[model samples]
Target: MKENLTDSAYAAGWALVKRLPEPVATRLFDGIADFVWRRRGKSVLRLESNLRRVRPEATDAEITALTRAGMRSYMRYWCESFRMSTWSRERVLASFEPEDVHRLDEAMASGRGAVLALPHMGNWDLAGAWVVVRGMPFTTVAERLKPEKLFDRFVAYREGLGMEVLPLTGGAGTLGKLAQRLRAGGLVCLVGDRDLSASGVPVEFLGEAARMPAGPAALAAQTGAALLPVTLWYDGTPVMKGRVHEEVPAPAEGSKREKVAAMTQAMADVWGEGVRAHPGDWHMLQRFWLADLEPRPEESVLPDPQGVQ
Candidate 1:
């Protein structure tokens, strides 16, 4: 019953938000963000804590201001996502201006396939739409949500945008599917910043230890695909900006396990650069760092990267 209520609430919210005028919805989201920030909601608090790790030297006043801005940015992502399905192809193509995109283009053209590792920042859906417009439809894995209806809704949403959605909990076959896609010169985008599974690869991020999903690196290593880290943030109102960092190639000399670890750390290092530049756009409201996590016995054992593949 509770799951049904939650699912219905989300469905209703999406319907209403999509129907709203752009200006009206933008203002409404701003108001909502302001209210959440003022109330110090758990989401806002978690975002603030995450920001502190990004900018440890920030004063209390600065942190407070940044938190408010972060809330606004986070709300903007929600607003854009709810309305993205209504966006036209031309509008989606114009919404994002990418930097260093040639790296991805070249990889795709080479027929070696490419793995795009992205952090949770900016409007990733917009980026995905742009990629589809550019003529390369991609596949992405999504975490299973509590309410099955809600999970189905999200899968439908991405599918409507021309992406092939796979379930993270689909077991070993999931990774096999992704690798097969890559070997066929396909694109696979993975959210690489946080690990949803207990067995994520440990890495140093933003000067602290954290676990990030190893699927991106493992996929690259297994398929000999180009591993690239991409970062997205708002350039201004209604415009999204992104940068594709240099590719992290699979090390030819290391063991597969060592190569995966090294590549994962390299991706983290590039992600830190982007997050630092636009801290507010990073919508990392949940616990991320090792220090922030509660003690769990299973954490000591690395989970198979295939779990998220």
Candidate 2:
């Protein structure tokens, strides 16, 4: 009953937001962000804590200011996502100006496929829509949320935008399916900053230890695909901005396990650079640093079905 209520509420909210005028929606979201920030809600506090790791040198006042901006940026992502389905192809293409898109273009042209690893910043759905508008639809995994109806709604939403949505809980075969898609010259985009699996690869990020998903690296290594790190951020404009970093080449020599670890760490390093440049744009509202993580009970770990480290 509770799950149904939550799902219905979210669906209703999305419907209402989608119908709102752009200016009205923007103003409404701004007010919502201000209220959340002023209330010091849990999400806002978590975002502030994550920002501290990105900008270690920031004083309390600076962190406070940054958190408020981060809340606004996060709200903007939600606003854009709710309305993106109605965006025209031309508008979608124009909304995202990706720097170094040729890197992805070249990889696709080479028939080697491309693995785009991105952190949770900016409006990734906008970036994905741009890719689809350019004639290549990508595949990505979505975490199954509570309330099956809500999960289905999200899958439908992304699919409506030309993404092939795969369930993350689809078991061991999920990685094989992604690898197969890559080998066939398909694009696979993975959110690489946070590790959702139990067997994530540990790496140093923003001067602290944290685990990140290794699926991007593993997929590239397994299929001989180009691994590219991409970052997205709003530039205080209606248009979203992004950059595709140079490919993080697979190791010339190493065991498969060793190579996966090295590549994941390299991905983290590049992500750190982007986060530092646009600290408020990163929407990491959960505990990320190892120091901040609470202890978990010991259990026998199974291999990640997604092939993440």
Candidate 3:
């Protein structure tokens, strides 16, 4: 009732993936690289344009290489995520070399809820599975997908990993649930990088401004949760680095708008650097900028982060 789902394609696809052994999955992933790499659809073209817009310094050759790498990473991410159900703790741990996991551990130990603000860079789905394996009580907001079947399947898989999946709408209600978990010293991972409904605050990214959802910053400010920067990448091996940027202090002291703006800007800076570092890893397929859309907002301006709280 909370989130609309799609047809069972995703569920069906994942079911097939789960049935395959690791070695088989790995092989098939590589075998289908050519098909995946072919830029045949509008989605892939839009993805390239987004990448170029973010990293204008990239040459056509570099863009192509990054695109190919992205496809491979995408395939591998799916394989690894489905395989999580069968993977041992040691096997799952092998994929992660947390450059700053201690930051998260320290926060969790203090019994204050911490927010893991993730982006589209690298394998976050894999990262979530890793979190559950490490015994962190994890939860996240997922935007509703059209149709209902697909959403249900995605939630079921996440729940299977011992995570509490919240629909983005009912997500606000789940904040207290997340806060209680945090108050108990647990962790909640939310993707802060996407503008789900184009109703996010604007922040400078790549070479231009892009909108990012205010949910993460708003929740952190509201709940007094520590907002942590988490970036996942392929270091030849999929690795996740969790860095405790300065804690997202509540706007309780300053103009709420100013406080939110500063916090959202900080997140933008971190995500921008990641996109620059691995341009292809950013998976923004939809038409993103306000200019790209047919009708612009009448009162278009940078999002007032403080206003959201």
Candidate 4:
């Protein structure tokens, strides 16, 4: 499993992006989206399969249109992440409506420490960066990218924006840090809708069973953290729109699995409301439900959040 080729490809792509201006980046992304949509290869096939899984009743033409929209959304996220350094704080804050900020404020002021759960729906990196600019730093978990160079580069970029990325390494790395922050009344944001790691708990989504990461729910149960689902949608606007759900009730007095399942359902309900409002903004590019068919034989050593890191 040599990752040199993958690393090289991404590095080259990012290098080209690093040199582009905002307007040029937008145009380049639009072009890339057009190119990806016109193709009928693995990328298109995977997108079509995911669309069918999520929206089975959609017509073939409807699925194709959704795939194109997903591709564009995905590209827009990448482009925006690269351009984050160039964005002014005023521009970033202006991206969200005042009502959205009000909901987030209400959730955070609950004093239980808000866990902003986002999906792969929109520009989440940008969303987190926006919070940082607004003077509220948050903790989010990310699986380390392959090739140490790329991983370090991403960490540097994110940390520069006041985010503390917890890497999914063995023992007290990311998750341990997350618990400490939450207990101390810090904001913890996680993307709970998709389990990119391929190891997650099965939950009903969009009227079908889909697997999502159990970490957010598990953390909520372990600690009395408030879980809030947040999503951003483009909606043909230069500045995107955002939605936020109030802090969900954490199932603390239940069995671990039951509590996690309840929390997962709460998260699913929040995300479902957002997706229904902006179906075109949902950006899952690969198959999600079928990943359970794949085995997760190797379990990593996860640290106890109660233990001090």
Which segments of model 1 are wrong by more than 4 Å?
A: 295-309
Error of 4 at 205 (Å): 0.9
How much is 193 displaced in model 1, in angstroms?
Answer: 0.6
lDDT of 2 by residue, 1-309 (tens): 977887887787679998998999999988988888898866677788888878889999999999999889988888888888888999898899989999999999999999999988888888988999999999998877667788888889889999998888855678888999999999998887887446888899988889998789999999999999999988888888899999999899999989999999999999999999999889787767878776663211111112212
In model 4, the Cα lDDT at residue 128 comes to 83
Give every collision pair in model 2: 199-309
Please give the lDDT score for candidate 2: 0.85
TM-score of 4: 0.86
Candidate 4 ranges with C-alpha deviation above 4 Å: 12-18, 171-173, 196-199, 291-309
**Model 1 TM:** 0.93
Task: Score candidate 1 by lDDT.
Answer: 0.85
TM-score quality measure for candidate 2: 0.94
Model 3 Cα lDDT, one tens digit per residue, 252-308:
567666677778878888877877777656656556665566554422111111111
Model 3: residues >4 Å from true position, as ranges? Answer: 1-8, 31-33, 170-172, 196-198, 238-253, 295-309
lDDT pick, better of 2 and 4: 2
